[model samples]
Target: MITKVTYLIATILSVKAFPQNIQLLSQLPSDPIEQPDSWAWGRHPKEGFGYKARNSLTLEQCIDNPETAGTVHCDGYDYSYPVELCISMPRLAPLKVCADAKFPKDFCVSNAANMVKAKGCQKFLTDMCIMDISLATSQPCADAEFPKDFCVANAVKLIKANGCQSYLTDLCTADVSLAVSSDCAGVKFPASACTSNANFAILDNCKGVEFPASFCTTSVQIALLDNCKDAKLPKEFCVNGDLRMIKAKGCSKFLGDICSQSLELANSADCLPAQKSVSVFRCTRSRDICLSQLCELKVRDKGSCPQ
Candidate 1:
């Protein structure tokens, strides 16, 4: 009898000799032709559009060759694996950078302005004013550190060039008290302070936006619309640290499946009665049916769904 150690050594030798010939596959084994049950195996429909077969290798033929494996058998076997396997996908540009066009133009300007201020690149304020602010903000600035006084002066130059002198004057006037008093220590700047400084542009809930999660980030102008404050949603769907839950119910019409805006619909009368949730059908036969009937509903409706 071949000991386990002997079998392992043999396998290693075989692998080294025919490394390129071995092919692995994901399919389970079919029963022998002589078994009546072999003819009764269930069938599935042809793959639908966009369906991709899992990436796997086939090693049956390689192992069956006597020259490759003298006595071991590798075919006509079925095994269920506990762990899932997947092929590595090639790296691609991040969706946030590539999909910036899909978002509001203001977001680009806001993002660019943030980068400029974050890096303390006061000397480039004039260059930034003439260049594409949208693209500039997507990448880090080359030189981000500079003297605070220089940055302050350069910021004034930017505000003037960007047609924001009056706005800055008003803001600085209003903020003078905070700057001088103890409140200055606790005052938190807005996320888009640079853009707001330049043109009074600010994105509401800017921190909450994420690609494929929320359709797009919204502004305070949209959130403050009628009944926006009274909207409510289940606690589970709310993003932590978001102060926008009160407007969720009212803003549900504008959000996507994975965003904070969708949380607003958690309290909809239609969903309240249905005990079935998207989470319940995750890993069973019911999952396919549930996805086909319900989860797709949300996707088809662009987020105002699962009702």
Candidate 2:
């Protein structure tokens, strides 16, 4: 009877121990399951967000998978597509968001004011404002902005009050004039403001302002004569070589003689190549013989030229 009881107890202990041993074996750590390197979460254009298994699955398949569902989040939501996914996947190439977005009128003006305070109005207009502000537009502008016309109106007011010398300086003179005549039409600016800068004196809007005689230096005179001699009026205004002309004329006449007869020249078929060469005179100064030949041909009748 004692042997039988001892054997039975031993059997019971062995059964329990067997299960305990199995549990211990189960608890031991094993190699981790490797995740696919190509898999990542991305935003879906229409369905919000999902995982993107770039190597193994298409965008549609990833979105369709039950494991990839999520909410969208992004700063420039109105101006961006596949919105939240752009922010979520920082490792991916950046998307061009708000590329064509324009700042709200009040907000743009306010931001312009802040920029002016930081860097002065000259830097704001010349350096910052001239760049494409549309790309800089974000959710704030979309949410709080007004119409573009309103923005232009207020911007003009800001310029008038703070002084727009830098805005009206150099090539900016023509750009500002065009803006005034078209989109900013009927927006009156002080004549004094236009005439203040010698650069603006040549523009039609700033007519009656005397051409500063001191502006035409020896280099400017040479460039003007070289590039514009024998060229016709109205058709091929020396607009193409305006930068070179401006550089030759110095800062006093920074706004080259774009509208004048002396500076106006032919950019017509005969002179196009020569005009191009003249435009880059600083680079092609040694090609004087080529330029003279082209210029001579420009004035001669078609029949007089050699084949």
Candidate 3:
């Protein structure tokens, strides 16, 4: 049942994905972004004119590196570029074309031509960056009495039966899991079911489900530590002790670092941590992500940041 697709390699540049060379794309003009939703990235920037553009730039990345990730572009849409990969960059090349042509249509579409050949490949990469940690992917997102088999699949089925576009966002975005058993807090599956999970093989069949903050509780915190353990613990955890070291995993600086790469080790955790100890695992992973971003940037934007 595994279908393989053809892919094209886009050879060029690095992976540090910079948003754009243009002032608008890179930095907002005013604080609060002056009704950010009104901007291109806004979900409802204008009445009957906005379509969730939060990670529009990321979408551009997907189009640029369809070869690396695997995907195809659909002709015609707001997206001027081809919809190639999940990690897409914003459209710059097509924007110019549309601007010069002075067409009413947005060029984000045709602009992103899929270099890769995999179906749904674009979404897979997007999930990695935007919605990477999902509870539906694993067993017992929280300690519960739910039967072992009562997994994301069942939840998907129930949700679809009820009729809904979103069914799993509640499972993975929480500061903690809410259900005591296999019951999925009434989340219904969308028409896009299997569209995400089937596409992403990395997490098996639990893609496209993003729980808010309810799933990030102490148990979830510990779970985050476990994930960090697998990825390569921060230097703080390695030195202070491993994730299970109670304190290391006890919502301490070490734990925070694992949950958020943005979070650095506290001053108390280590002085001159950079010189004292840098996480080999983190450094390597970050570099890899950085590389992916760079390559995506080069091909998608034509030597310039995606517009």
Candidate 4:
């Protein structure tokens, strides 16, 4: 009986031990073998499944046949997609219809100015349609509106063809002074070139160009001399020292002793020498008396006097 009971207990323990061994085996790490079409192969589409052949057709042909065209490349090979498809793809490049297409002569001629301005000189010069239009209209480049960069590159040609006035006017509008441009070297402008344009006159290149005496007023001289440091002004104009003295207090007293009626007389060749001689007198005595005494000394020493 004891052997029979012990065998029954031992058989029960063997059955429990078999279940625990199975549970421990289930808990251990495992690597499943991958199947050919299983999810382990990745979610990407297989080659040739979603592929589409690139349509080889001109933009004009594609535009004419939209449904048959499918996705047509507009901007060469850089951007190969339809215009409508560009909305979905924000990275798509801009269309270059004018660059790649041929338009009617009348259309390009009529819109030449606008097109050239929009495209700029660099692009306008390269575009066949725009270049043809430029040759037809002869604007912007021919007129005072020529681009500064373009003018700088072709300064000699433009100046020789249009003269310095027109070239300077264009350069002035662009805020490029001839003073800083080596291309303007040895170019002699006309005397009246900068009369109407004060901005042009103040350019360093204008210093050598003569001006009308009437234009060189005291106020204008102040501005002109400030810019044209080495300008060879007419002798009649007062020097910087004289101009300062004229502006100082009691300047009228000196003017009365000198030539009060006319500025030209005050700076004249004869008056300059007389003024220098009288300068040592300090204006304590009458200017007329001092002048007379000097005149007598000159007459006695030289045995003759100036008429």
lDDT, candidates in the order shown:
0.32, 0.34, 0.29, 0.39
- What number of backbone clashes does candidate 2 have, counting pairs of residues 3 or more apart or in separate chains? 1
The predictions' CA RMSDs to the true structure, in order, are 33.5, 22.6, 35.9, 17.0
Which pairs, if any, clash in model 2?
104-145
Task: Give the C-alpha lDDT of model 1.
Answer: 0.32
| Residue-level lDDT tens digits of model 2 in 52-165 | 323443345444442333323222122332434422442211223422223333333344423322211222243334233441232222222233333344454333322232
Residue range 138-241, candidate 3, lDDT tens digits: 22122212222232335443222222123344332221232222344334333233123322111322333432222322233332433223333334433343
Model 3 stretches astray by more than 4 angstroms = 1-161, 165-181, 185-226, 241-243, 246-307
Ranking by lDDT: 4, 2, 1, 3
Worst 10 residues of 4 by lDDT: 42-51
TM-score of 1: 0.18
TM-score of each: 0.18, 0.19, 0.16, 0.34
Model 3, CA-based lDDT: 0.29
| Model 4 agreement with the true structure over 46-154: per-residue lDDT tens digits | 2211212233455566555434322443323232344344323222212332233333334334445444432222233323232442342354433323444555455
Q: Which is the leading candidate under lDDT? A: 4
lDDT at 276 for candidate 3? 21
Top candidate, metric TM-score: 4
Per the 3 Å backbone cut-off, how many clashing residue pairs does candidate 1 have? 9
- At residue 261, give the lDDT of candidate 3: 44
Tens digits of per-residue lDDT for model 1, 1-307: 5696795576556445542422223333463223322222221333211212221223455323323221223223332111111001101111111211222233323444443342223435434433443322233433333233333444423322223332443333243332234422333334344133212222222223221212212443333333234444334444333545334554343232223223333334333322243343221223233334334433343333233
